[model samples]
Target: MYIPFDEMVDTSRVWIYQADKQLSTAEQSQIESKCNSFLQEWAAHGQALKSSFQIIHDKFLVISVDESFNQASGCSIDASVALVKNLEQELGINFFDRTKICFLVNGEIVEIPLNGIKSEVKNGNIKSDTLTFNNLVSDIRSFQTDWKVEAKNSWLKRYFQ
Candidate 1:
């Protein structure tokens, strides 16, 4: 069912989707409603899935499922992707663009194309200590502790060296 994100266990499976741009207040509200409805009806093999979601920095959508309750089947996973695809169509936002990298700059979220990372680093716009959003985290505990990490400590470290 639709559990509050805070109530979900730390080991819950997570998927983070970064929007190409920040979502407006209205867009966030619409997304919240749509997600809540989806989670309410989300099931795997007819068993309800305990899930919750968080919209972070108006740019990332973090979805979590307590798989200990019931493992998510391939079909259920596909359904979640479908929901994201529908939202992309409705909002004209690209949520699957892995080429756009996110970073925290002066307390604001900034996106740099993956190809531009080297130049940004060379220009000093991106530093080893810059906070980067690592969307590859696979579970809630890692999402909580490692999602936002310093560039030197993340996969982005290669750019620095």
Candidate 2:
């Protein structure tokens, strides 16, 4: 069954999908409804999966699952992918694009194309202290930690030289 995000354990599994662009208010509401409905019936091995989701930065879709109850099976994971595909079709939002990277500069969010990471840093657009989002985080615990990191201390560090 769906639970509030804050109620889920810190170790809950998480999946972060960042949109290529910020979503409109209407789009956010629609996506929220879709996520809620999906989580309400989300189950694993016929057992109701305790899950929740939230939107962050008006550009990210964060889904969490408390696997302490029942681990999500391959089929359930496929179902979640299907939901994202349908939502992408319906909203024209691209959730699978990994070339877009996000970070914070001057207390604001900035997006840099991954393909141009080298130039972005070489030109001083991305700095060492910039909080870059490492969307590769696999669980809530990691999401809370590695989801954001200093560019110089992360994969982006290579570009600095």
**Which predicted model would earn the best lDDT?**
1
Least accurate 10 contiguous residues by lDDT in model 1: 152-161
lDDT of 2 by residue, 39-148 (tens): 99999889989999999988899988999988998999888888878889999999999878898888777888878877877798888877898887888888887888
**Candidate 2 global lDDT:** 0.87
Cα RMSD, each candidate: 0.6, 1.1
Report the number of clashing residue pairs per model: 0, 0
Best by TM-score: 1
> What's the alpha carbon RMSD for model 2?
1.1
Off by over 4 Å in 2: none
Q: State the TM-score for model 2.
A: 0.95
Error of 1 at 21 (Å): 0.5
What digit string (tens of lDDT, one per residue) describes model 1 on residues 1-161?
Answer: 99999999989999999999999999899899999999999999999999999999999999999999999999999999999989999999999999889999999999999899999999999999999998999999999899999999998899988
